[model samples]
Target: MRSHHLLPLLLLCILFLAQCTKEEDTSPAENLMQEASKISYTYPALSTEPMQKASTLTAAEWNDLANWQLWTPQLKLGAGRLVQEKWHFALQHRYTVVLTDSLHKRITDARITLETSQGTLLDESRTDNNGVSYLFLTAPTKPEDLRLKIVYADQVFYIGDLNPQNGRIEKQLNIQRNVSPVMDILFVANTSLATADKLVYLQKELKEIINKTKSQSDSTLHIRLGSIFYGLHAGNSVIRTHPFILQPEPTLLTFTKPYTTVTHSPETIDLALEEAIYRQAWAKNASSRLLFLLLDTPFLQDPGTITRLSSLSREAARQGIRIIPVSMGSMNLSGELLLRSLAIRTNGTYIFVTHPEEGLSNPLSTISTYTDEPLNNLMLRLLVKYSKLN
Candidate 1:
């Protein structure tokens, strides 16, 4: 009654334990498959055909044509464009206020307030690293009826009877303080299986551009660089983000290395862009914030695609961050439309590199020149008038 019963009970217990171990060992793989199945890969119904005759266009032509307004005539000009044509000659007034020290050095972080003649606040913003603030007004409120006030270094100065309709207004304070302009740039690359061969070319072009931009920067302007590499492998998302740094060569090398890992399809571009917009260490008072996205894959139109894209683009626009998307190879209509919309929403540029294997040196050069210029300038008459202000 003792030995025989104990032997059977031990055998049963061993079989149960082995079964439990087997389930535990296989659960992880099962869970992964389940997750992969849950992912909805809804490609847009539009054709995947690439743009026609894109390869014939020169780099300079591409630079001029990359604007979103040219691509979509129905939509208004992007917010990034300072000068926009008024529809039907409507009274839409946009004013730029530039503050400078006596020595003509741009002032940073100065509090600017626009008020009405009746002591009502119209808008308020702090001057960016470029010592510029933007005030937008619509019809029924003329610039002549608005007054501008600036507060800097605990001192307040006031300018009344603004006439920005003619051009931007510049005010030179008697103070001698100067602040260096700050700019931040981040490069986001898609290192998936589809773009494996083009990574080397991209890496070389990026390094060259980085060096060029660095050489152009002097003590007057400070530049910080960062990068993000994104891919999907084995039903999991892989994203590598580097913080802003003075030197990003090592990070770029590691990110753009030869791709031997096999990646899954349906790029997580939305997630990569979300990380770029929200997770990056952008300066609060940066004069310019830019993101250069290189990708050939289209976004997976999942359930959260619209909401995520809308929120990300709005946030980028609010922060005055411009996104430059460079489509590396032949892109589908869906991908083109999405990227184009993002650029327009954020006042950014959408660039299509018809030949990715050739590298991006030409386009990068164009971008460098474009970013080096100032966003706004006052007309000669306005400058003359402003010079006489107290």
Candidate 2:
């Protein structure tokens, strides 16, 4: 009887130990799931009503908006440039170079090199389709010490030995060559289920703008419009890209496609942004490269996502691609921070769609109030007068 009792007790203790080991093995995964749940739970519901008045931002307001310190602390991890004081000062000292033909027409695809009198190359950039290039000089580097070497259409031009003070400098180069201004605008849209309704509104606004722009016959400005639609479905990111075209009808069709097949997962914004940055067919010698990102979803906050975004922003800036992020719905904290970071990083502007139902014309009127000039013309004016470059 004593042996039988001891055998049963031994088996019972073994089973108890096995159960404890199983719990220990699953605890980490369980904790991760709980944390994810908590994050989603804390997110506020998407707002149905407009949150802000539709108005234009002044130069002072734009500066405040670009300040990264005003954003959430989480943004600081990926966007180090915005937090650096040196980088901010460098932006202020930026100089603009505009190359034009003797007839005043812009020259495209011009290679510009900035160097010291000693031939130490400081920085170099190619003129965009708009015939614009930007260069920066740091402390201890006087404007008189700077020299420029420009190569365009197999001809080389040099300009140097100048005296410039602490204020902004705008240099004009009248090359012997002439090229028409080419503008390429790429519209990126999020097609996730959460933002389905906003997509409809965006399509209407885009159609009106496209028609209005096309109606204004500015032979000097050549405009090509394209679009990209992105979403997540069946654990995969789906992206459809349309190349820049002079016609708008086919490009507008993409915005009408239904996204009901999307899975329960949130949008793959990182992949969408990556596609917008790399896969699009931007004109090589175009004068302007503009990317308008429209979305209502919050981006993933994972480290990998943030790092990728940072890298993409830098690349876009290098390519002279301006990214304008337009918020379609009431903005959330995380969404606003990420959008603003991208805009600021690429030296682009941010717009909030306070009243989608009212269309983007009134809100964007500040961009171009004149019907004859249209949006792109106004954009160029803003670049010259306010932002100072395309």
Candidate 3:
């Protein structure tokens, strides 16, 4: 009897240990998914007008930028006739995209009916005037429950998925704003800053150009101004800090406010001012100039860097740095989480290159390589062209 009781107890202990070990082995990614599941994206109240007004780049601009590789849209063409598939909502918004080619002929007429998993939701159509017809959907919906059928051009083309969260298909035109080819780029060379070399490169190349001639748009072409402070506590020093010199000689485009002295503090006022300049770089009818930042990550601002990202996101909208977080560590799930956190917080993109040697050399490289080299080039071009339109 004693032996039998002991065996049961031993088994129970073993099971308990096994469960504990499994939980221990589970990674942060698992934990994050759990957290993400608990939360749902609620659309902000900002009107569609602002959203439309905010983007000045037209289809042509986007396409031109695409040519330059500034930004690219993510495209997904189905394997064949997309019979059926399941999809989840992103940002609590669900959408469908349909595309059809008339074999080789121009598709003149087509009607589409949308059905949800539950039942029919919408019936719509457009007759091709020239060669094609397209539609824009602004409302959000629930998942795979949606379907489309071709009534006119029955065997025209396969059904393609158009999930807005995954891709943007809007026709983008370029805004024609002349980005100054030359400027006085401030090289704030803090050991804490990551892209010091790139700043130095811009300073060297652009400064010369700004000195030689004005921008084609006839606006003064200066990218940055003031000093490049390098050293510990250099961020705190008043000598090169803002307010000390806010006048016109060295125009204040962007400034890296001192890193948070306390946990979770917002970026300094000076930094905020600089971001304003960055956002207007492609503003319609405005001189194209920018001020960017290259901050080293895991700073004192917030723990896990997650808590502090909200303020960063707003700043990103106004400022041009496109908040990129470079981890000194490997690009693992945790590192990616950090990057994602920054992206969420600042409306910026993330790049995970582990070694310092492999990091971007300067601020321009981030735009030139990451932002401009991508498909958004189309957006940029559209904006540039749009400026001319104005």
Candidate achieving the largest TM-score: 2
For candidate 2, what is the lDDT?
A: 0.53
RMSD per prediction, one decimal? 21.3, 16.9, 18.3
- lDDT by residue (tens digit), candidate 3, 207-315: 3333333322225333334443322442452224332121234234243443334322222223432433232233221122222233343333233233334334434
Q: How do the residues 1-390 of candidate 2 rate in per-residue lDDT, one tens digit apiece?
A: 000011334335544554566553433223222222222111122222211221221111122123323322322223323333312323324556777777666666577777887778766656655566655554447667888888776777778874544333345555565444566788888776645655654454455444444444344566778888877656677788787787657545557564637522356467777887788777766556788787754556666676677668766766667777865554544455456667765657665543333222221011211111122222333333221123
In order, what lDDT does every prediction score?
Answer: 0.53, 0.53, 0.29
Give residue 55's lDDT in candidate 1 (0 to 100). Answer: 29
The residue-by-residue lDDT of candidate 1 on 8-113, one tens digit each, is 3433554455457644343322322222222222112112222223223212112222232233222222321212231111113446788899888877667677
Give the distance in Å from residue 229's predicted Cα in candidate 2 to where it truly belongs.
Answer: 1.4
Better candidate by TM-score, 1 or 3 = 1
Specify the poorest-scoring 10-residue window by lDDT in model 1. 371-380
Candidate 3's error at 350, in angstroms?
Answer: 3.7
